[model samples]
Target: QSNIIKAEFAEIGERYNDKRRSEIIPISGDLSIEDIIADEEMVVTITHNGYIKRLPTSTWKTQRRGGRGMKGAHTKDDDFIEHLFIASTHDKMLFFTDRGKCYWMKVHEIPPGLRTSQGRAIVNLIGCEAGEKVKAFVSVKEFNETDYIVMATRKGVIKRTALSMYSRPRKGGIYAIEIREDDELIQAKVSHGDQDIILATYRGKSIRFNENDVRSTGRKTMGVRGIRLGTKDDYVIGMLIVKREGSVMVVTNKGYGKRSDLSAYRTQKRGGKGVITIKTTDKVGNLVGIMEAIDDDDLMLITDRGIMIRQAVEKIRTIGRNTQGVRLAKLDDKTYITSATRVLKDEEENEEEEAAETEEE
Candidate 1:
């Protein structure tokens, strides 16, 4: 009865063309007493015209051998697998073309062990946009040599020196500024205020204050008086000195002895005839009408008080002339006296000269 049942089942399989139970499967040229199952791993070949063709296990090898299975599979003419068979577990898809172009797509989630055609169909149904162009290779370090030919469209191609800082404008804002160094952004901010000045030290410490706090005593700019505190006290306005002869002398406005008490005793000395010589302390020019004395180049006042006094160079000035009332000679580089004339005595030498003439022709 079992043999009869087997014969009846075989006849039924032959009539139905069931290769699973048939003795010989003409497609793969193999006997299949058991069921002839399709290969679990099925590859979908996509043509250039976007046609998908599914080949079974028996016909897959033959189609591959005939160079007609996959669009870009096993070909040397730059025709590579354009479509990737991504499983549902893959969150990222990496695709490479025969022409060396690469693409990377990131998906939120993928379905499980999905068929290639079904995956492609779902991808088309989702209508996702193509990813940005990415480099086929990634470099761990920066390329330093200039000899390398750099592609212009490559990512992270910069013209700045390594680790150099830069100030750039921020996006979506007009008043925003960004500082970046070595392609990394930094933190900084700037603002405006009143007429305040900031003083920064070499050590990076700074002090800021308004103009009033730094104003000068003279109501001038703080800079006009300089940063020193005692500059005002050092400024000399006038000077006064008393001579030993009970005469008072004062100097002001770069003039010397302008207000003198010796006007009544000008031509007289205490116990002898005397003359007063007023001269500028500076040797180069006259100071306050006083011709510069040869010895006192800066400025000196000689008085019958039997005392010689020198005033400050800035305060010394020429005042007037000698007793003869002649203007004193202005002291300069070119003025010099060669000689002084003196009268020769002739009465005592007349008899001696006559005797000498009688002795000589």
Candidate 2:
């Protein structure tokens, strides 16, 4: 009886058509594993301690220039949102770290939450070293060789690499720029190679040079000096790359900020003693950041105390290089503006007719 059962099983196994059946597959592989959250634009925020989240474009009602914005984040006294950007959920965000490595992710990958709620840790989403901190990140639809990412360091070093070099990123990330032990990567801006670069120093000094001055270099190499620091206390704080339009904005920690005409900061050779970009005074405090923006752009100011204020850049008076800037944000004894970024004009205008209808519903 045992021999007969074994023979029957063997005959059944041999008769099965395993080869042809295994080759059959579905007609289409187009089913999406990720949700479609790209219908609306989002405002993403990254705190100093690496907490990040995204909110809808309609999070804060638009405000006029100089009108202190609504409190946008509830952060610890020591932590504040250091970076904020306007991007579509479908766009890819290339997170660049201080160690010269980068991690690529989509805006949708960042879980959506309220502005007051601290979101997930960015380091977890994009694997990074223990001590590595994000220095700069940019959003792009697709990497193209026509555009370049110009990076600057705390020691006044600058490097430019083609965007195509970062098209393919890894789980562990790859080299974006080389840095010495004593220096640190500070700022990054995307622009055409023909644009101009404005490097602002801590002590209210800045230099404008043609982007062509710094030739494109490899991803693993260090760059040449973009400015000559006037004092040991002064380090490069802001690096703005812009074409012929827009004004250069200088903001101080004490809440003083002003917009200066780009033409006022005449183009100079790289690595020179930059002219006075802002007059630092006891009341005005130290220069904290600089931005390339126009009157139409909306300014988002983040205080070290975690307070965020959104105002129009047009409200801030455009002054000269030697003048102390006007009050861009009102500050208290222990609070002051730390970092600031701009939202484009079109992105801020969310088709009022549609937004009003949504809110009414």
Candidate 3:
């Protein structure tokens, strides 16, 4: 009655005052795509053949060190696990391909799967070309203009571009780096434009160079050589953007791994043969992967036979870069470590869960 005008009181008779047919409800505001999707922790896994999927983080239970890990995926004879990382469903995922192109999508856009499901082909999701292979997957919360995208190729080429340059991506992907014939992009990292970039080779050689050493280039240009390969067979295996505090963790094919101090790798000129990272011999084998890891991080090691073991980084021995690392995973002769990644400590996840519960309340 208060909302009605005095002049309209006569028009509002018994029929007008009848019971309302609909209820008036209120909403906070318009909802966005992200607002509808649940922001939960997800485990993202990519196979060597470019099959990708995301499963709930609780799919795998924590196991003690040296416990036989469960089979992570069912792959064909030639295909195997290539990459694994944990991220939130709301996070942005950057997919860098060996063909020097980059694609962007939200983590929730990836096909969801169960523990034993073979994932959808990455090519089908990102519209990759017939022969293009996704070589690296980076999860970022936000694309800050001040940050930079650092990319490395198997032939030791490295490029740095402003992160804002890649803020807008196309469905078919855009050129990230110009690769010469026979050279392919190995991996990419998002840096703050002043951190150190480490390029690790399969032959146990690594070169640490500041991100500033390579001049920032446009998206479609070829980068300068960041390291010199000893031979054609000794290509770059992994790249790491490191800070001053954490150690450079390197894992070998034979399940041997170690964490070397960041101080051991002095910043060197780009294009020089790097210092010895690990002693690659008949026993320890060649390097499989390397990462910037801290004591609180959990290391996820995957073998070529689809076996995955999550070991605490602190359990791995910290030694000089020139010596062979201690045994991180016991492997049979037929199985070898293919790739490794880090899972942050549970404190962060616990905090996120609590925050979500609060929001729900």
TM-scores for candidates 1 onward, in order = 0.15, 0.71, 0.71
Better candidate by lDDT, 2 or 3: 3
lDDT for each of the candidates? 0.25, 0.82, 0.85
Worst 10 residues of 2 by lDDT: 344-353
The TM-score measured for candidate 1 stands at 0.15
Candidate 1: segments with Cα more than 4 A from true spot: 1-39, 44-59, 62-126, 130-153, 156-361
TM-score: which is higher, 1 or 2? Answer: 2
Cα-based lDDT at residue 248, candidate 2: 88
**For residue 341, what is the lDDT in candidate 2?**
75
lDDT of 3 by residue, 37-110 (tens): 99999999887677889999888889754344566778776566567788899998888999999999899999
Q: State residue 280's C-alpha deviation in candidate 2, in Å.
A: 1.6
Per-residue lDDT of model 1, residues 170-205, tens digit only: 221111111122221111111121222222111111
What are the per-residue Cα lDDT tens digits for candidate 2 across 262-330? 889899999999899999999998888888888777787788777877777887888888999898877
- Cα lDDT of candidate 2 equals 0.82
